[model samples]
Target chain A: MIPNTMKLFVGILRPEKFQLILASGIKYFAPPKNYDDIEIPERQRLRIYDKVPLYPSNLKPPKMQKRLRYMRGPELLHNKLQLKQYGVMATGGGRLRHEHFEMVRLQVARRLDMKRMFAIWRVDPPWQPVTKKGQGQRMGGGKGAIDHYVTPVKAGRIIFEVSGKCEYKEVYDMLRIIAERLPFKAIPVSQDIMEKMAADEKWQEENNLNKYTLKYIIQNNMGGCHRFISKYDHKWYGKYV
Target chain B: MSFIKKGLLQSPVPLMVAKRFRGKINVQKPRKPHFEKQLLIDISKPYYGPPKNSLPEITLCENINKKSYKREIDNPFERILAKECLDWFNTSKMVVFLHVNSISMEDKTPVFAALKKNDMHLRTYGKKIVSMATKGTRYEVINQLFTSHQNIIFGQPENAGKMFKILRKAPQLVVMGGIVEDRLISKNDLVEYSKLPSLDIVRSQLCSVLQSAGSCLVGQLNQNQQMLVSHLEKHIEIQNNPTNSDNLDTNAKSES
Candidate 1:
């Protein structure tokens, strides 16, 4: 039989009352809600334009004289490094509009899980602002109000890089579809293809074909007379011409 | 009357017992809180140390007749550059050399920037190839080249082909080497190289071949078991039906 004093003590310290005190203490000291638990607002997802936009007319596009001619050619230097497993290169040169870029972005994003796999834009979207006069207005008195801005793409420019937890073969057709939608002649190229092309070019020149080839003459259109004297030919002899 | 008297007596005793217990029990005393001094550690300071050497000492030969030269890569940074080249060469099955002649610095800037950006992207996927302007002596010794022209080397055979396609577009840069299959190939050979499928495609093709072979063996092994099971079922059917066995005996007798 239990002592009368002990029985009285046990009766005072009931399990239910002790548990209630512990719960209240824990409620007071529990860590604040985790940062990751905070819910993002729906309004933040909406697109918002910048407060002030720059005028495209005010800025000057770099004079790309020599570079412009090579735009339609294979990308020579830029994007030479195989930064991604799969990439889309613009084979044909033309102006790329904002809508076109957005469409391509949406198409790629829809196909690829944007979380595991993502794309890096090689070309910048047109940020220059172009204002226009009313449609019925007559021809320009001063410079006509600027039309919409555009990004001028030369051939051989890499459009975008797709990478991360994605296989090249799986994304090949998807990328091809995106390339078809692009205004310029765009093609899907992997790191291997690019490297092979570079190697072939190097091999040709090493054998002296690049220095004295009929293809060079036909491509450059230096008729038979100027075939020997290329524009790159240096005048080793003193200028006694 | 006795039951009512017992209940009334018990209730009064409990009340007196509770009063007596309250007097005997001592309440718990509150503890004084103790504060500890906090130690603040600074982690923002950057650590500095001597540069690490990354390049391995190896002899790269240019041709059969030509003697192999030992390249002098003295600086730690130079070793890093050499190491990058070596890494690309060893990892890639194909390596390419290019001679960029007469392009002005202004024009080269954008090209360099693009190459650098692409390099960063490639590094992420472990397909990155290094492209650095050849410092005549240093690069030539390492790459086993004879040209004095401004050159660039793209390493990693898997990616070397793609770089080849892009390089082909630049009519100005002359390709100097196409190393593969343990021998140097001529310009015409590059066209053949370009026609080949990428490494991933080849790997997938090989995997499919192996998978088909495995599946064929599994099917062959399963064929005998299936035949045996069917034979056993036919035998059991004959044993179960006496009329079918008698019909079979009559057919055999008629044939004879």
Candidate 2:
């Protein structure tokens, strides 16, 4: 079985994963506003959702003397709180200073269950906060200037590509649980499990009874959400009757 | 229990710290006044030190070299030291966190002095004149930390690890701590620290001989199972250095 990132991410965030994410930080993901269907290559799909390694990315990938040597059945699902936090903090055109990253470093490291885990960021120029209140009731009105940053990145969308080969089903269950429970709503639907959920009549009824009701469900969970309805495309798996 | 032991002995830095004060540190490092208690001792009415309190040297006098010279003991010093530490804090206090890992030269004497009087005040807060023990382990100090905090880190690695074992079984307990890496240290590292023959292992041995090691972990379960188990790590870090949390929000492209 040639393993892949999609399989890995699906396997970790099962229901039992809720407690970890609750403490770790919470936020799922939103589809990229400028998501391109054709451009994303096969290898880069992992980056689209999320992926963390047990070993340092910078370290040279060691040659496998024995395929068994590389076969540690390691797997992880991050703290839900962490995913949400990252979704809110990273998705928007916000730039996190170095130390802000460390606050959650311990949890992130533990999730990967590896020695070292690090991340770098590149932010697009964000919009300047409006100093003056908008006339009457405007979008960026009153309340201290609604600081907006513009980025090609999309916040509120969580996509994790977990790896390893133990209890992949549990991981999938965790992703579903984390997605629903996170503070920020990441479409409250999993691209990873859409196929399965679409096939499962019971799950579809529990999650998407009606076209508009499901929208409300996602919104109620995440409050004022914009689903990447387009991400699933014409072949939307969990399309309600 | 076995895991905790493995974690402790496997601590990143092995070997207990027995030295002290690398002289003063640069202002940049953690020169927090809290880390410099010896200064507090000196500035306040001569709490502890030499001249009159030296350990009796090997009895040079031939006549005195005989019999059980247990009377040369500075037993009173340790009692006085514990009283002073409690008094120094003013009002009552609990869980004296002596970093048994780090102690200084001047620090060693007080620990010995404290140990003599059965005092467990000093602990290593990173190699200095902070503290040490008679047998050279702050096991007693750790036992106290556990007694006071209970569900917090107990003295040994097994005790610490037991928390997670219990927590794994009862997730409602709300595990929390200083957030080492991301896992709460209270339940995380302390559990890891519980194992690995620490000063506690030696101290427990002594306590056993004295038939006095207290019952472990039973009283430590979380009655506050429903109450939020919060460790001050994240809130403190955010408050002191908002940027230190490593908040990565680069993907947020501003609404164009």
Candidate 3:
């Protein structure tokens, strides 16, 4: 006789309870088809939405001119240092469209898993809409309706920053592909490369090898005019003093 | 007595019994009441919610507000190119700036393609140059400018040779070095340098030569052992046969 603790029951009392209990059990008999067994047709699997209504273009209001140039000097140096991973920097300036941004974002997201790997949009998306006049329309009437929008990218501006668990070699090809497809010329740059460039620039400046200085230009071009100028002369007075 | 009563009685007796417990109740102390003033601050609602007019207005320039206006005349676009050029100068071992000023668009296409191809090569070599430039006390940038092309084809020794050949074919494109050594080389000298075997090829050749020399020494060492083995076999054969040994001794005496 089997002990009570060791005894096992083989019969099923309730059919519903049998399924609930034996759901995970190994099946000796063929299993019945459930709702999940039904096949979905390929055509009906994906649904497409109708055209979306267009909204009025929200253009950035014209404001007082601060600086004439879009981006000058090394303003993005700190930004580069902060996100010191493999990224793409625009070598030439141009307008980037909304579709371009979406395509790039989709391509990157598809290739790299968003959880472990991601990209930061260095440039803002196209917010200012540009309008075009209809063909053969009179020149003097009202302004044309908004056609499309674009984000004006300046040279030396970083368009995108891709970071996370990825090596430069692994990311370089993707970045190069993105760079080639971009409207403006762009180049793949890594943290080490940028750091090296910055260090080289600093070294050049320290050793006075940097020929861009005003003093160097003056010395080379004006033949040391500082010798003729009096030490007591007013600072504002031209080099003639 | 019943069996249950007998079992209970048979069990061990209780060790002790508890007596009635007693305690004194003390009066609680009176609680002290305290009053404090409360201050409220009216937090301003966010400007984005209803009534968009609450948002600050940005002043527009009269000229800019006009339908069509020209941008300011400034060369901001050139700055990036200048910076890139500076980087090339700083990083490259050699920079051969081809004077495409006179070269036609048709002629320039091939050159651009070649440059594009060379850029990939440069990237491969970029790491070595970067490391070399970043390390130690001396000016690595200057050293790199003189020695490394960063694997890029444009300033690479081989590319320089190819460029020399191209220059020979098309005399119009003048090559100028952005960062050249003080001691200048003629066109022929540059062509010669380019014709010379690359570092990899030279290293491989040296390895092969060493391998051959090692193999030759091993062969020489083995030759003496082979001669001794043959002599030992002859001596063993002479000792194994008395008649052959006697014939061998007669033959030796006759030969002497």
Candidate 4:
């Protein structure tokens, strides 16, 4: 049987829907939403971030290796939210510069209703030093001078979170903008959306009809594919880059 | 002489000489200045810049991702109170909104007592409760009056005159407006309505006015028959006694 709402649309188009109206069931309208539980925190805006990490004047800024592992495979830590409400989650691996941090900060500050909603950074500020040589210089003597800084992010890593009395719709646009502008693929997700995605992924895995799935193939190392793929592919079953 | 003349016109010579001497540096060692420690306040200021990409417009279909569920989060107490207030709206013939200033319990008690004595109730409800009670009802227009502390006096329309009398004694409760007999009226209109006489008295007065017109018509209709009877009786009296005819004739002349 058709819902009563459908007959309303049909009636609008036909204007003579007495027969259709007689066929439909009774309509019960949805009640309004209640926001009794949502408590706005003391502060309801993105916190200010330092341009660079604090370093003592006496000690020179420390240098480190490329550590390509940091940006490969899915993030094992900082993947879940500290204050779960809504946030931008990275879908691919990449590095975020200080400029990206400023972009996210400014966009959140501009759009967030400070009285009802607040946003916070989940990823650290730009702290990894990136080395670079002079523009026209030949091969660098020893290691090149440390130039700028960046924050390495991997798949499933939450870049920032917004919480408080606001619904996901209030911050969706701002989070989506930040996610799109990031170096790698990312998506805006609320806590419910994240949980649903996880449940769907598990359901798909459990209900797979195919005998030869990617996880199965990777785990069994069928056709000797281990030689061609990197250790990350073996570890994550080729799910994340 | 030329130098003296220039000095006289432009500058005082003795003062210029003093200025040149004053330019000499101090030869004595300067005293040590006191020092104070500086406090460094680290304020993490927000950075604003040109966004690399523009934000997409808010689309209507965005809520499709969210799962809808029935919310049963209404407060039970508020729900009951709202229902009770709705009953007040339905049953009462008049609802007068009064603005309550800052009044202590002692000052407020007498006003409440007076209203209670006259079969009127003075009630105060929160803005939320009032809005919930008035929502989608004929009494919804009174929702705007709930901006500040407000009291509602509910009673019959006839008792409005008595209500106004009691309210006049209490300076705290100022009648803003009210709904009387289902019609919304202002404070002045309410006062004017209260000044009107009771319904029964007005009805009786109208009945007397209506009956007087028919009574006057009946009196006019019987006047001709009554005059004929009186004239015949006087003629009989004159026929029985001829000596009394002169006295009767004088009476008839007066009558004519």
Chain A TM-score of each model, in the order shown?
0.55, 0.25, 0.54, 0.82
Native A-B contact fraction in model 3:
0.00
User: What lDDT is reached at residue B168 by model 1?
Assistant: 50
Ranked by TM-score, top first: 4, 1, 3, 2
| Alpha-carbon DockQ of candidate 2 | 0.00
| Chain A of candidate 2 compared with the true chain A, TM-score | 0.25
How good is the docking of model 1, as DockQ? Answer: 0.01
Candidates' DockQ values? 0.01, 0.00, 0.01, 0.01
Error of 3 at B138 (Å): 41
Q: lDDT per residue, candidate 1, A71-157, as tens digits? A: 333344555434546788876665566777777777776687554455667776664434566778887765545466556565567
Q: Give candidate 1's TM-score.
A: 0.31
Q: Which 10-residue span in candidate 4 chain B carries the lowest summed lDDT?
A: B36-45
Q: Rate the local accuracy (lDDT) of all candidates.
A: 0.54, 0.33, 0.53, 0.77
Q: Candidate 3's residue-wise lDDT over B63-92, tens digit each?
A: 566688565333333334334444654555
Q: Cα miss at B51, model 1 (Å)? A: 55
Clashing pairs in 4: none
In angstroms, give how far residue A164 of model 1 lies from its true place. Answer: 0.8
TM-scores vs. true structure, each candidate: 0.31, 0.16, 0.30, 0.45
Off by over 4 Å in 1: A1-77, A127-140, A203-241, B1-256
In model 2, how large is the Cα lDDT of residue B42?
28
Ordered list by lDDT, greatest first: 4, 1, 3, 2
TM-score: model 3 vs. ground truth: 0.30
- The TM-score obtained by model 2 is 0.16
